[model samples]
Target: MRTVEEHQAVVTGLLAPLPVEDVPLAAAAGRVVATDLPALVSLPGFANSAMDGYAARHAEVGTASEAAPVRLPVGADIPAGRTDVPPLLPGTVHRIMTGAPLPEGADVVVPVERTDGATDVVTITGAPDVGTHLRHAGEDIRAGDLALPAGTALGAAQLGLAAAVGYASVPVRRRPRVLVLSTGSELVEPGRPLQPGQIYESNSVLLAAAVADAGGDARTLHFVPDDVDQFLTTVRAELAGADLLVTSGGVSAGAYEVVKDAFRGLGTVEFAKVAMQPGGPQGAGTVDGVPVVTLPGNPVSSFVSFEVFVRPALRRALGHTSPDRLRTTARLTTALRSPAGRRQFLRGRFDGEVVTQVGGPGSHLVAHLARANCLVVVPEDVTELPAGAEVVVVLIEGALQ
Candidate 1:
């Protein structure tokens, strides 16, 4: 059986970065930048007032005080967006609003509260230092400067930065398109009448949702019956635009294993048993030049396999910097035994400090899996763990506890 690390390495080695495309800024959120973006214009663009005040030379009000005020003529009203106002008159004040362009030769802004707001003449009761309350052009960012570097994951702040720098659209790495398929003869869709000995099909939905949560565009194809020819034909027909293909079921060593029988000698596909609990039988390779990954049919096993191998591959293809699930250390709240020689991933509820198993080590326990927020990882060397033993926990959903 192949070790977990060896199988993960194989899956990573088969993938290549997806192509980049230009998308509007509104759609760039959660996408990775493909190239460095430079600022098109300087921030603030022009010298403006940071407050609503009178613009004047600070020297003119040098000795003005509450007891002895200095009065000067109000030259003009410089409201915001007034582009035709004349320069400041010497020894006079200009009534300026916030964000309005500072009149020429004005070195300071005395707030209206300090000066009597008069149209004919204003009284200044205080002095301000030169260059006060002035927002200079390019003070925040200069023209042609790098706004955002390549490989930046665009979130709210990053998208705002792109738009502030005048980018209507940006070049971003396209999300990987994943096609999920399930192959089994004893399976029927939910809400459909099931025959005796048949079960509801769920692996395709589970794997597709996992793919989407890991930043891939996922779509599930109809379930393929346990026939080699039909399986191959369906996979081939849907291989045209898929960046990656994932199939659940029909890879184990069974007489009617459609996936194994159909792709036995095709492309570079290889099937092997992995040294892990729940999900052991795995397959990875290419079909018609598109990367294909196969997982076990059980819903829990399929989800665990995607979390271990396929999630990282899809995230990497989408240009994400961190592709692995977030892991935390927690103490076990109850004793548990794992199969010797196999690494175990048991579903559990993690409460920040202690992890309690939700169910037994069965791959078909979907209800217990639903109540789990983490996967408690047990190394192959350890067969049994005490209640207080420290275990590595992979946060799958809910809070990071």
Candidate 2:
């Protein structure tokens, strides 16, 4: 049997990063930048007023005070967005609004609070330092400077930065297209009447949603029966557009294992049992040059396997800098026992420092898996652990209500 890390390495080695493409800024969120984006124009492209004030020569108001006020005639009203206004005349103050372009030859700005409210003649009672209340050109970012570096995942702030730098579209890594399939003759679609021995098909929906949550484009084909020829035909038909394929079921050592039988001697495909509970039977390979990953049939097992393997591969293909789930340590709220050889990933709820098991370690307990916000990990050799024992926890859900 392969160790968990060995299987993980094998899964990751099956595919390379997807190609990059240029996409509109509207669709760039969650996509990683392909190259460094430089600023096309400086922020605050021109010098402007930082406040509503009077533009004047600093030397004229140097000695102005409340006891001895200096009165000057307002030459012009400089409102925002007015570009035809002339430069400030010496010894005269201009009434300037916030964000208005600073008039040339103006050495200082005196706020309205320090002047009497007059349109024609204003009484200046205070003096300000030179260049006060002025926003200089390129104060936020300079033109031709690096606005966003390569590998940056465009979030709200990153998108805003790109827009500020005048980017309508950005070069980014393409989102991976994943084909998710669930195979079994005993599976029926949900909401339909099931026969005596059939159950509802759910792994496709579960795995597809998981792929989308990891920022990949996912499409699920209808469930295939336990026929190797039909499964291979369907796979080949859909393999043209998919970067990776994920199949659930038909991998265990059963007589009707269509997935195992179809690719048994492909030379590129390998099926093995990993040293992990709930998801021991795993498969990885390439079919017709497209990466294929086969997961176990149980709902919980498929979900856990996706979290352990497929999610990382999709994230890496999307160029994520940190591809693994957030991990931390939490104390066990109760004593628990695990098997001797397989590393256990028990569904759990972590309340900051203490983690409580949600259900028994059964691979088919989908309801328990739904209620879990974390996976409490126990090493292979640990058969039993007492209450309050610290265990490594992978935070599956960041915020749990």
Candidate 3:
């Protein structure tokens, strides 16, 4: 039997970083930048106003107040996006809107609220310091400065910054193409009436969604029969376009284990029993030069196996700096017992400081898995943990708090 870390390392070694491709900024969200991106132009490219006000020389209106106002002639009306701006002459002001470029020789901006509403001439009742309400050129970022560094993940704010820095498209690692397949003789699709001996096939849907959440492009193949030759042929036919082949079923020690029976003789793939609860039977290698990872048929086992092994590998291949799920320590709300010599990942619900077990340690309990936001880890040597014991929890569904 192999340890969990050994299997994780073996699975992670199967994939390499994908090639970088230029994608439009609209489609660059959730992708990692492949190289450092420099700003094409400085932020606020020119001096502009931060508020709708009057742009004037501070020396002219430095002592103006509400009781004794300093009246000045309005030389021009400047709104945002005006490229050709006239200069402010001595003892004059320009009516400026927010984001409008400041005219030459103007050193301050007095907000319109402090002055009476006027068009031909304006009243400057309040005095502002020089450079007040002014957005200086290159204040946020200078031209040719680093806008985004390599390995930075692009989110809403990152994409906005990229667009503001004059990037229409960005270079990012291509999403890995994953092909999901499930196999069983007594499996039937959902929404169809099930016979007495048949059960609904759900591993493909579960695995495919997990792949997409891990930043991989996923495509599912219909369940194959439990025949070895047919499974091998079907898998080979799809390997030409897939970067990784993920299958859930038939890898355990059983008479009808087609995945183990089909690939055991091949020199490329290896099957092993990992010393972990819910996800013991694991296999990984290449099939026709495309990487393949086989998981257990139980829904919880399949989901946990994907979370532990495949998800991180896919993210690493996509150039994510942090490939693993967020992990934190929380005190257990109730006592629990784990099997000796096997690492256990129990479904849990974490509320910042305390973690409560969702259900019993059963791999077939899919409902319990759905309600869980985290996985409470118990090491191989820990047979029993009393209440209030600090346990490591991996946040699987945004349980950051």
Highest-scoring model, TM-score: 3
| Cα-based TM-score, every candidate | 0.85, 0.88, 0.96
User: What tens digits encode model 2's per-residue C-alpha lDDT throughout 1-401?
Assistant: 99999889988887688798999999888788878899999988889888888988898987899999999999999999999878989879999999998999887889999999689999999978888999999999999999998878899999999998899999988888999999888889999998899999999998998998888999998877578887888788989989999999989987988999997757777999999998999999999999999999999999999999989888877777788999999999999999988999999999898999998999999988989999999999999999999999999853345
Please list the residue runs of candidate 2 whose C-alpha ends up more than 4 Å from where it truly belongs after superposition.
52-72, 105-133, 397-400
Error in Å for residue 246 of model 3:
0.5
User: By TM-score, is 2 or 3 better?
Assistant: 3
TM-score (C-alpha, index-matched) for candidate 1: 0.85
In candidate 2, residue 112 scores what lDDT? Answer: 94
Q: By summed lDDT, which 10 consecutive residues of candidate 2 come out lowest?
A: 392-401
What tens digits encode model 1's per-residue C-alpha lDDT throughout 1-401? 99999999999888898899999998877888888899998877789999888999888877899999999999999999999878988889899999899988998888888877888899899877888888998898888999888878899999998888799999988888889998887889999998999999888777777876777898898777667787788789989999889999888987888888888868579999999998999999999999889898888898889899999887787777787888999999899999998999999998888999998999999988988999999999999999999999999964233
- The runs of at least 3 residues in candidate 3 whose Cα sits more than 4 Å from the true structure, single-residue gaps closed, are 398-401
- Candidate 2 global TM-score: 0.88
lDDT of 2 at 145: 92
State in Å the error of residue 146, model 2.
Answer: 2.0
lDDT of each: 0.88, 0.90, 0.93
- lDDT string, candidate 3, 46-109, tens digits: 9999989999999998889988999998999999999999999998999999999999999999
